[model samples]
Target: MDSNNLDRELVGVLFPGIVKNEDKAITCLGGIRNISQVYSNPSKRRLGLSFQPENPFVRKIYGNSKKGAGVLLKVKVKKVKEGNEIKREVVSTTVVGCVKTMFRFESMCDFQYLAVHREGPSDGPVSCCLEKILPSGVEVIDFMLQPSPLLLIPSSFTRFEKPIGYAYTDKRHPDRSSPEPGDSVHSKTRMLRSSQVSPYTFNLTNELPSEPHEVYVKQKEIKFDLHPRLIEEYDVVKKLFDERPIWSLNLIRYHTKIRLVSLKVIMPCLALYMKTGPWRSTWVKYGYDPRKDPAARKYQTLDFRLRHAAGVRSMIMSREDITTDRERKPKRSAAEAAAVSDEIAEGSVYFRRGMTPTQRHIFYQYCDIQLPEVEEILAPEPPPGYLCHQKRGWLPANTGEICRDHMFRYIKDTLFNSNNTDLKFEGSGNGSSSNSDDGGSDGSDGGGGMSDEGGFGSDGGGGASD
Candidate 1:
């Protein structure tokens, strides 16, 4: 509370953990304790000391001193037993001034307070005092107290390898039938032999008989002289070379339309055409416009429109439903639509028409389905009275009768055509009647021939052979 005390430097003591002698002491930042006030009288030229007791003497020293002042004291540290543990306690002894008289002041005073000031604590009790006091100018300096050497309490000793009461056996052991020490065995008679033995020894000794040299026979080497002929002369070889162009041509014809459907199909076809030449032309030819065909065109356009609408709808409905009924439903977006379209274009869709039974079989093969089951399910029953003609490969002699028979039989027997109640022969009341000009007669005699084509010579052949 005193303004003079405010100008005075404050100082406090610290007990550092560890410090080398050359290291500068760092200021201790902590609460003050063990506050002591010192007053000097000019009459006696004597100093008086008064202190407030605190748990660590340094805390009180720090509290009583001015802001910055040189505090000198000899600290006595002792580790005294408290309860079951020994904890350190520090006691501070401050020297106010040199002793003017030897009269006793208090019962707490000890001979350690009589020691002269030294830079640090000495081994024995030494006398010390504060002198040369100033009113306002005071420099604060702290002596870092050294802590007592750490005494390590002994720990209970433990043995790392302790004896166990029971003996342990290994779980992994060979079976009883496995080879053991001192077992008599023949190498050749063993069921299994070591791979180290030579395999050739078994073949030489076990299988063969030794024989003496036979009578001498002269060996002759026969050689035939061959003259090379041009490969073009062999019809088969020449045909192979010549057919390459035809194959390439057929490929071009068959694959031109197929290429429009998929590049995967197109690329292999192109490679085959390039390798085989013109032979693929007939197969690859696009005779009819796929889009112009009425039935196929309508179906394709409807399919395309439906796919596009579905894709648009999917793009619009992009949110995934979280409810249980719709949790597993796929999220629809542009990318998903594109993926679905790609799958559809890659896979085959069997349209209702334009496919023969053989073509359907091939399609099933393309789809990797078994064909035998399909054949069994769709097998047709033999027509009445046609059983005898079927084995001989002969139809009725009349052309009209044959056509009439096939149309009626196919309509009656086929599952697809059986329900067509309006089925009838076109342009004929009697389906068995022939409408040809010769009335079903074979035209060998030329009954309606134009006059001998201006009369050729009838004797023997008169035309020039050349």
Candidate 2:
């Protein structure tokens, strides 16, 4: 048969070990009943087995060879309880396994191993051994069995009007529409069409409106009643201004979070005082500027007012004078030079004064000068155009023991002296003596009353005159 076209069912049998009397057979059958109940449980619904006895007593069944023939026993299985009680019936089939040819009179009997199948057409065999002998001499045995194998049968189950058993035509209904192969009755047709009547038809266009569409709505205007106190307060405030005042009562109510009457009365009085004080100018500058159009100036005035009020309140409540308590300690005198010398002797080479010329120069450049030396070094030099009448090469001596401050002052003085001498020479000398005709102006007053020979005089003479 074709493997694709097969129908199979699952069946089973139970073999009781041995029975010496009729009552023993009944007891042996009771064991099968217990196994059936176990199989009927929902969890064990798939479990199924079948056993067939080959002999009534001890009979040997032939195998491939007579020497290796196995024993077979006549086994009968009766349905104690159907397995479908708890679940759907499972499709399964069963077959036989090995058996012992000899009847052993031992405390326990053993049977051969059995094989189980998962998807084949046959259920493999199971083996059993007598474990306990009942009081009636019946053998109570337990066997290990495999789950039954089921061959799923395929049938031509379809929703066709007629079976495909044979191909034929009905002569009585010759005009009937024959369905094409694989045509389904639920099929539908779809159509697509263009809105234009003809393929070459052109669309007509319309001109758009020149003006934008405007929508007008009639909204009901609501009027609220002003409290008597609020009205009086508004009147008082309005009296301050010649024109009718436009006060926002909502703003007053929002700021105070109080009744309109209370806010209106209190706000105006507060505004009156605020407008008279130093805050008056600030208020006008920030909030009450009538020069500005209302719509153009949004919440600028209100924001300024809020900030100003907050600042004023903060300033009034804040402490302007604050005093702090700090501990004072006596000033300590500078350590003696001898102590410093001793420390230097014990410190690193860098700290000690035993440095090379280069090291000493670097150290001196890095050190701070004393106040007296700093003053001398930074003192302003004599003005340019001043004569230095001292000996030309009279160089100042450098004292080896000179402090850093004094050394700096000496360098500054030397630079200043050199600069003054250069200025004096340049001021006294003219470029040439050929221009004697233009001497009166250029050589005398032109030179600012200073002579070419490094002297000050009204005339162009090399002499000093007061």
Q: Model 2 reaches what TM-score against the true structure?
A: 0.11
lDDT of each: 0.24, 0.26
At residue 163, candidate 2 shows an lDDT of: 30
lDDT of candidate 2? 0.26
Error of 2 at 68 (Å): 94
277 in model 2: Cα distance from truth in Å? 21
Lowest lDDT block of 10, candidate 1 = 297-306
Q: Could you give candidate 1's per-residue lDDT for residues 353-389 as a string of tens digits?
A: 2211211111111112112322221222223433211
Residue-level lDDT tens digits of model 2 in 259-332:
54343233333232111111111112113333223221111111010011111112212212343322233554
TM-score for model 1? 0.12
Error of 2 at 411 (Å): 53
Error of 1 at 376 (Å): 21
Name the lDDT of candidate 1: 0.24
> What are the root-mean-square deviations of the candidates from the true structure over C-alphas?
42.8, 45.2
